[model samples]
Target chain A: MENEPIIEVRQVNKSFGKNHVLRDFSMDVNQGENLVILGKSGSGKSVLIKCIIRLIDADSGSIKVLGNEINGLDQEPLDDLRSKIGFLFQSNALYDSMTVRQNLEFPLRIHWTKEERLKNGYSAVMEALTDVGLAHTIDMMPSELSGGMRKRIALARALILRPKVILYDEPTTGLDPVTGREISELMVSVQKKYNATSVIISHDMNCIRITSNRVIMLIEGRNYADDTFENLKKSNDPKIKEFFT
Target chain B: MNPLSTYIKESPFLKEIGEIALFTKRFFKEIAKPKQEYAEFLNQCFWIGYKSLILVGVTGFIMGLVLTIQSRPTLVEFGAESMLPSMVSVSLIREIAPVITALICAGKIGSGIGAELGSMRVTEQIDAMEVSGTNPFKYLVVTRVMAATLMLPVLSSLANAISLYGGYLGANIRGNVSWNLYWFQVFNVLNYGDVLPSLIKTFFFGFAIGIIGCYKGYYSQKGTEGVGRSATTAVIVASLLVFIIDLIAVQITDLLGLT
Candidate 1:
């Protein structure tokens, strides 16, 4: 029971018309591990997490999240399942029309009842914002904030729901080095604080090194390598070493 | 149907028509569901209705004023100068006001909806709403569409009134017609037959503008360029729809012996 896999993907295949993005790719993420999926540009890393959440339907696959098969779940149960899994998109997809407070409160608006939110919504928003060290910027719009602040607000929005598993897509792609490192550290600490499993999709080595307990390299749309960061760094395989270089 | 779709699938125009038909069907199905976004709907109403008041009013006034001035000379030639107010009121309430108002909205509200939704799609905000377990269509599309549908009739009615006042001023520009006479003649010439069909068609015009705008924006691609295209196309399609709807409404009313 202690070694149970929370998110299980078995031989998933996805294609866009003539483009075969993910071909027979498979992986298993244990209960509380931070798994970094390393892939080159155009690889099916983003598509994999999207499939896991059923945002995009796969061509063929068996994807089980929290012991429930997601490929065929009805809309009601699918939405319930989604509430338990937090997704942080690469774009930090904050609602531009909403303030930081409203952005953080969006999930609560969906998943919590009127009374439940009345009791705890404000504190939950504050706590999530404080967790990312941007509580002072709560009333501000996403446009008013800097790039890094926007990312943190997005993370706060993701964490406000207190999900069992969090999926991060390119968490540190477009930021400067200093800001990227700060976000990486914040990710690791927040993961520890929430005691939640994390699946991070990124090509940034610094982010991968700081946050991932194990690395899975996606090459040509399949599971090419799976090992600890140090072990993968020391490997002689050019396919693995090319990423390290 | 499948064979037809497959055959015309290569034609972009035909492809978009198919897409819009499917989308409109989905809108009907989704709007029937419970848990309506009332707050957002009201917000949209404010944006679509309250905000567009001045523009619609100004255009309506111009339509009435111009029609009265242009038609007065012909009436005078026939020695029917006294019928100026009645003719202007009949023409405007029956046709001109509703069509002009719908075209104005197609440019203003339609393009605005398109650009807003297109930007939301490009930024992945729509996907974010889905990832948060919220129905983006219910919140974004339905609210805006409903607002537009409800607001257009209100705007068109307001335009009709303003345009009649403009017609009064036009009638007075040359001839010395009393205010009481102008009001009496305008009302006397207008009956249920002339007004009802004109009013009925505005709802269709509103629905067309809302649906076209949302469809264009929802499926927009290619980033900023796509957003521009969506906004431009929404305006073009909605404006064309105004004329088409008016033509059909006039034909239907005539067939029913309402004219």
Candidate 2:
């Protein structure tokens, strides 16, 4: 599917009352491309991602994922569509009341076959944990895990579905520099291994430089820059420079 | 009324009305969605129902005993001591047991679910579900609602049985009502008309608690503070809904001449 775009967000506009978060924002990701979105806080980075996933409805424009127009789909098909994409939130978003195993198993149990769930599930969970270097802590609760471990568990959860696309919303925001770099590298490695389209939302220059092949910046509720990191840095716009600096 | 107080009162009242309307719309939208989360349903039943048996059982026994003791002397003053068994059974099965059990559940299960889902919302776990192609509402709302609906009736049934036993213990503490005679009086007055409608009402009570809790928690904004608010509001609203629904059930039953 190299000739086809995996996710296309076209001219999307989102407004929460008078505050317009995304104004005619547009972007695209081809199959297996790792696209990182760079924007300061409140630059509509998250909202832009949310609109693509239909988590937050766009007031106007279109979002087509896997060749399906997601905007008009009902809940059943919407859920079907959602099952194809994996999302990692900034907080890691693990279910605190459940064990780490349960957290990893939740989505699988919800969507997969019982046999597939019980038989393949354990190995999948272990594989995902090992992939993230957290194989020893399967039974531990989320509250018991450190920040980096939590992010890893979240990554494992995203991998459970073997999704076509993975969306990371500030995946390494709160980690220490070393941990954050490690996470960025893991993200790159995972995307490469799965050959999955990855859209990462971050303002961190290091994360962008390390993981992204292409960077898109959202400024003043629209696409301000969409190019390689090198080209983005060379853009003469002071606002874009300020964002990079 | 003072201008400030008047505005405060009106603003909140209007806000509440708006919230109720929004709640109604969302509830309808959710119901209209066809895909059901059966796994979540079973999981919640296991969590909210099976796990809560001990708490409800203990509370039910104590409530029965206390209510029996409290009501006995009044009946005795009127020389209606023999009426104790029938009186206690009717009250426990028809109103007290179900209502009390629900309030207990609202506090226990409702707040627990609210806080759980609220924190999920605060932490963007719900958003994660959205992106991963899971209907968070199906996984969260349907399961919790179904659990509450099915479990509340079971809990109330169990509570009613224990409460009657508690009443029996209370009666035997003083005078001479045989176990056979006490049960004879209880079964004599209690019928499907009395029990079924009451049982039916508990399902609605359970549903109200589950839906309100999930709704409050799912839509919670403002992070940790939102979670606390969702939990507190869920319990309060669910308890109030229990009484309101109970009142409506009672009226409907009376209108149908079931009582």
Q: What TM-score would chain A of each candidate receive against the reference chain A?
A: 0.98, 0.97
TM-score for chain B in model 1: 0.96
Off by over 4 Å in 2: A1-5, A234-236, B1-36
Backbone clashes in candidate 1 total 0
Per residue, candidate 2 scores C-alpha lDDT tens digits across B182-239 of 9999999999998999889999999888888887888788989989999999899889
Deviation from native of the Cα of residue B66 in model 1, angstroms: 1.5
Candidate 2 residue A139 Cα shift, in angstroms, is 2.9
Index of the highest-lDDT prediction = 1
Task: Evaluate every candidate with DockQ and list the scores.
Answer: 0.84, 0.59
Q: Write the per-residue lDDT of candidate 1 for residues A1-245, one digit (tens) a residue.
A: 44599999999999999999999999999988999999999999999999999989999989999999999998888889899898888999898989999999888888999999999999999999999999899899999999999999999989998988999999998999999999999999999999899999999999999999999999999999999999999999999999999
TM-score of chain B of each: 0.96, 0.91
On the 0 to 100 scale, the lDDT of residue B97 in model 1 is 93
For model 2 the interface RMSD, in Å, equals: 1.8
